[model samples]
Target chain A: MLQTPPARPGMREDEVDTPALLIDLDAFEANLDTMTAHLAGTGAKLRAHAKTHKSAVVAHQQIARGAVGQCVQKVAEAEALAWGGVADILVSNQVVGADKLARLAALARITNIAVCADDAGQVAAIEAAARDAGIRLSVLVEIDVGMGRCGVAPGADAVALAHVIAASPHLRFGGLQAYHGRAQHLRRLEERHFAIGAAADSARRTVEMLRQQGLDCPIVGGAGTGTFELEAGSGVYTEIQAGSYCFMDADYARNLGASGKPVAMFRHALFVLSTVISAVRPGIAVLDAGHKAVAIDSGMPLVWQRPDIRYVGASDEHGKLEVPSEAEAPKVGEKLRLVPGHCDPTVDRFDWYVGVRNGRVECLWPIAARGGFY
Target chain B: MLQTPPARPGMREDEVDTPALLIDLDAFEANLDTMTAHLAGTGAKLRAHAKTHKSAVVAHQQIARGAVGQCVQKVAEAEALAWGGVADILVSNQVVGADKLARLAALARITNIAVCADDAGQVAAIEAAARDAGIRLSVLVEIDVGMGRCGVAPGADAVALAHVIAASPHLRFGGLQAYHGRAQHLRRLEERHFAIGAAADSARRTVEMLRQQGLDCPIVGGAGTGTFELEAGSGVYTEIQAGSYCFMDADYARNLGASGKPVAMFRHALFVLSTVISAVRPGIAVLDAGHKAVAIDSGMPLVWQRPDIRYVGASDEHGKLEVPSEAEAPKVGEKLRLVPGHCDPTVDRFDWYVGVRNGRVECLWPIAARGGFY
Candidate 1:
C-alpha cells in the first residue's frame, strides 16, 4: 500500500509525502556553518544541543562542522547519539534514580560523558554509579543564572557543590553549568542581551570562586537558538549550547536580528506537512494537522504560502483554517506546509521525518530520540 | 543500562517505580464494562478510540469487550492497530495524498476498514487509490455537527456528499459521521447538554435528508469522555468514541457532573512520574518532567497528592514546584507524580509506560502508537 517516493530522488518540492517532518539540507547546513563561522577563531566552543535534532545523523553533521560535542537532557538521548558514534555527551541535567544513574554511568564507558548536579545527594548517586561501573564521571555544578529553574545559587553555593564534585574519586570537576534558559526567548533583543549579561556575570563570579577553592573550571555551558550569539560574544561562556538553530521554529522567528529584521540563521525547514481535508464552507478549510500532529504550546501552526489563511483553532486531528474571502479557498485534497510554533515538542509527535529534497522523499529518518524522554 | 523492573508484577502502589504510567486495573476494567453495559441493548456499538491508549494491547482488550472495532486519526495508527490484530478500523478522518490513501485502502485487504470525508476531491482521491488497488473502500460523509473544523454542512451538502460516496464504484457510503467534537469539554454540564443538543439537531437533520435520498446511514459515530453519556442516552449517536476514559486526564476532571461534583466516570490513573532534581531554598523544588515530559497546552501540570506544592513553570527539562510555607518540602532526588492538564498529546511524549501497581513496575508497555502521527 505504501506509495513510491513522491518525486524521483533529487527532484524538486512536488513529490514529498504529506505529514512528513522536513529539514531543508541547504538551510540546515547554512545554519550550522553560520553558527560555526560566527564563532570562528573564538575561544567559545559549540556543543550543539542534540535535544533539538534528536537525530544522530544531524548530530554527526554538527560534529563534522566543528561542534565540540553534544549536550542532551536525558540518558536515552545520550544513548541514541552515542550509538550513532557521537563520542562526547553531557547529560546537562541531574541524573536521579538508580536506574537512570546506572544508564548515565554506562554511557561514560562508551563516550566522553559529563553530567550536571546541584546537590550532594545527586553527586553521591553519580559517584556510586561510576564506582560500580568502574568508570570516572565528569560532573558540573549547575549555577542558577537567573533562570529560576534548575541550578544552585551562584558564587559560594556553586563553589560548595563544585567541592562535592571534586571530592569524589569517581567524579571530576568538569566546570560550572551556567545556563540562562529564560534569556533565550525574551522576545526583545535588549532584554535577552541584559539577561545573558547578568548570567555571564554570575558564571564569571562562580568561576573565580571555584579558582579560589583551587578547582579548575573547564566547561561553562548554556545558550539556545534564541540567544547563542549573545552568549558566544560575551566571552564568558566557554561552550555555546544552541540546539534549535538548525531547525528554527516560529517562536525563534520572533527574535529580532541586529538589523531588526527576522534573524535568518535558518530557513523554515522543519514543517508539518498537512493536507486540507475539508473544504465544506466558502472561505474555510480544515487541515489534518491538529494537536496530535503539531504541538500548539507556543501558538498555532503557520500555514506556509498562504498568509491569507490563518490557522484559527485545532481539535486532536483537525485544524481549522480561517480563509480570506478574496482568495481562492484551498481544495480538499490540497497540501499545505505548517511551520510549528515550538519545534522540539512538535518533532516528538512524529516517528519518521520524510526527508525530501526537491520534490521526492530521498530518505526516511526515524527520530531516534523522538520518545526518548526517559 | 536499562534497569530491572522496579517492582514485581501485581505489586501494590508503594512498591511501584517513581515516574511511571499507572493504570488502575480495576477502574480501567470497570470503565470498559460500564461503556459496553450502558449501551448493551441500545443497538449502538463501541468503536473505542485507539489514539488515547496508542497501544495494540489496549485495542485487543477493547475488541475482547464487544467493541465493534477501533478508530484512529492517522494512517500509521491504523496500520499499528491492524498489525496488532484489530479487525475493524475507521480512520475517522480524511486521508489526502496518494501515499496515505494507498495505505488506507491497503488496510481493507486486512480488516473491515472505513474512513470519513467531507469533500469531492478527497473522495475522488480515495476512489482513485481504491480503484488502483482493486479494493472497495468504505467512505463516511462527515457532517458538521456543530464542530466547525472538519465536516460538510449538515443538510443538503452532507446528503450530496453521501450520494457521491454511494455512487462511486470503488467507494461505499458507510454512514453519517456527525461528531460533536467541541461539546466534549463544555465545562458546565448544562453547557455540554445544550451543545450536544445543537449537534444532535444537525445530525438529525442530516439523517432525515439522507433518508429522503434513500441512504440509510449505518455508522453515526462521535462522542468523547466528557459527553459520552449524552450521546449514549440520545439514541441518535450509534457510536461513542471516548478514548480518554481509559486514561482520564486533568482536563476531564474539571467537568461538572449532573450532581455538580466532578465527573467521576473514570479516575485519574495516569501521571508523569518525576523526581525533584533540585531543591533550591526550603520550599522550592525542581522536577525532571517539564514541557518535554508533560505537555502544557491545556495548562501547567498539577502536583499529584501534594496540594501544597504548585508546579509554577516549566523549561525544556525542568519543572518548578512552588512549595507553600505550610507544605512539607521535598528533598532533592525525591520523586513526585504530576497530573497533566491534557492527556492525548502528553501521552504522545513518552515511549515506555512504566506500569505500577503498588510502588513497582508491574509491566512495561511500549506506546506502540507513540509516534504514529503520519
Candidate 2:
C-alpha cells in the first residue's frame, strides 16, 4: 500500500513531512537540459534509466526532451511505465524464471519491449514465453565490458548467445548490452577514460565480429552518468543509458572532470528532507531520516550546505548528526536537506516526490515503481 | 500503490516470483513459541516491535500468543497497524513536525496509542496536536540508554520530560523508553551483559526518580532480539520490545552465548528468495536480487545453506555471487534463499510476504507498512 503524500502543492517546503523525498524543480530541469546539451554533438542518443527516478512522470519528462526511450532493470518497472502511457520500454537487465519472462512478454503487446539475455537457456525461455503470448520479443545479448557482474565474454561468447537469440522463432536479436558498471565511479578523469576506453574496445570488437558473421547490430547500449560522455564520444555506442544525471547523488558528484575537480555537469536535484527530532546531547542531534529513508550503502549522506554538521551514523530509523557544539547543533524540529550517497535505492524508499521551487512545494508526483522489485 | 502478491496459496515455494520475501511458516511459528516459552517466567510482557515485520498479520499472531501490544517507529506504521485492527500501539521513537504529530493524535480516536518524546518542543507540539484533535494522548519520556541516537539523559532529564508530559492538559506521562539499541548486537556475552547491565541501572534510577516526583512510570519498554533475555530478567524493564525474535536475521544469529558459540535462540525464518539470472563467468553468477531486494546495510546477505557460494557484491538490481568453481557454480535460473544482513529494511523492500510451509506457499500477507516511512 502507498503511504500518504507528505505535502500538497503550494505548501512551504518546510511544511512537508520529515524524511520526505524532495526534488528541487529548477535544478532537476537544469540537469535534464544539461544532459540533453551534452548528448547533442555526439551521435549516441539518451535512454534515461527509470531505475533511478522510478516514476513515469520523470520518465515522461526525459522522453519529452531527447531521450529515445526508457531503460528499466525489472519487468515490473516496465509495466509501470507502459501503464503510464510510455510507448517504448527496455529491460536493460536479464530476467530469469518463467513467471517474470511471461510478464515481460505480456508487455510487448502493449508497448515496444525488449530484454537482455546472457545465457542460451534464458533465451530459449524467453522465446517460449514470447511464443506462448503470441508476440515477437526483442532480446539483446549482454556482454561483459569489464564490470564482470553479468553478461558473457566479449567476442565469441557474445556472438554465440546472439545467434541463439536470432535463431529463436519468436525472438529477435536487438543488439548488444555492453554496460561497464564498475567504471562509472572511478574518481579521476583518466581512470574513467581508461576504463570506458577498454569497455568501448570490447564493444567495438564484438560488433565487428557479429558483422563479419552477417548479423547487423541494431542498438549498442552502455554507460551511466559518470562515463556517459566517454561512451557517447566513442562512436560505437548508439544509446547511452545514464540515469543518475537527471538527479545526481553525492557519490557520482565525487567523479572528477578534466580539471581534477568534481564534475559540475549535473546539479544535485534530489534530497531527503529530514527534521531534527532529538538534540538532547551536546554536539549531537538525531534526524527522522536514516538508511531506511536515505540509503547509506554508497556512504553516509552529506548534510546539504552544512559542512559543520556531519551525519556520522545511521540506525534503521534514526540518523545521528555529529555537530561542532551545542551552539552550532541543529535545533529540535528544524528541517534540513541531505544529499543521499546513493540515488536509486533512496528514491525507492518513498511513495511521493515533493517537487519544490522557490522554497514552496510545486507538485507531488507518485513514485509508482517504489516497490516494483518483482 | 501496492504491487500484486508474488504467489497464491498452495503453490510451491519454488514457483513464487524471484526477489520474493519468503517466510518459512514452520520456523516462524516455532520462533514465536520459543519466545513465548522463554518469557513465561519473566514478568516483562512482549510489545513486539512492528518495525521489523511491519505486518498486522504477524502482530495478531504475536498478540494471540499473549503479546501485550505492538510497537512501531513511525506514525504511518502505527496507522497501518491500527487500521488493520490492532488495538494497542506505541511509536517507539521521537516524532517531530506538526503534520506527523497531528496524524498521530488523530489515531487516538480509534486505538489506544502512545508515542515517545525526548525534547520539550516536541512534547509541546504533541500537546497542541492532541488538544486540536480533542483527545488526551499518552506521551513517554525516552532516555538515552547508551544507544546515543535518540532520547535524553536517564535520571533527572527523563523525569523532567515526564513532568512536562504529565503537566500538559491533553497529555499523560505513559512510561520510559530506554532502549540500548547498540547493546543488542554485541558479539560476546559479557559485552552484552556489561552494556545492558548499565542500561538497566539507568532505567531503574530514572524510574525511582520519577516515583520520587509522584509520577508513576507505567511501562518501561526496551530490549531487542539480541538482549531481550538480559532486559527481561533485569527487573526494571516491564515490557520487552523484541520484534526480530519472531524472524531472526543473520546479524542476530551472530550473537554469542555463555557457551562461547552463537546464541542460537531463534531460527532464520525470513529469506529473500532470488534467482540466478546469469552464470556465464567461470566461477561467478548474478542473482536478480540485489540491495534493492535484500538489504546490505548490516552486511551482504548470506547464501542460505550454500557455504560454497559467497554473495560478495551487490548493485542496484544484481547480486554477484562468488562460487567455488564452474562445476560447483549455481546454474542459471536456480532459486536460492538469502538471509538478509538486516531484516527490517529488507522487509521494507517488498509488498507481500510469501508464507511457505513444507516448501509450499500457505498464505500471502500484505506488508501493510511497506513504505510507511512518513
| Model 2 C-alpha lDDT per residue in residues B1-374, reported as the tens digit of each score | 68899899999988898889999999999999999998888999999999999999999999999999999999989999999999999999988888888899999999999999998988999999999999999999999889978888999888888999999999999999999999999999999999999999999999999999999989999999999999999999999999998889988888899999999889999999999989887888899998888889889999999977899999999999998753377889889999999999999989999999998999999999987878
Model 1 regions more than 4 Å off: A1-12, A258-261, A360-363, B1-19, B41-43
Q: What are the per-residue Cα lDDT tens digits for candidate 1 across B1-374?
A: 12233445666554454445556565567778877777788767888898888888888878899888998887888988888888989988878778788888888899889998888878888899999989999999888788777788888988898898899999999988877878888889999999988887788888888898799988789888888878777778899788988778888889998898887777777888777778877778888788877878778888888877899887767788999888889887677888888888777766666666545556767667665655
RMSD of model 1 against the true structure = 2.7
Computed on C-alpha atoms, the DockQ of candidate 1 is 0.49
Q: What are the TM values for chain B, all candidates?
A: 0.94, 0.98
Q: With candidate 1 superimposed using the best TM-score fit, by how many Å does residue B23's alpha carbon deviate from the native? A: 1.9
Q: What is the lDDT of residue A325 in candidate 2?
A: 58
What does fnat come to for each candidate?
A: 0.53, 0.82
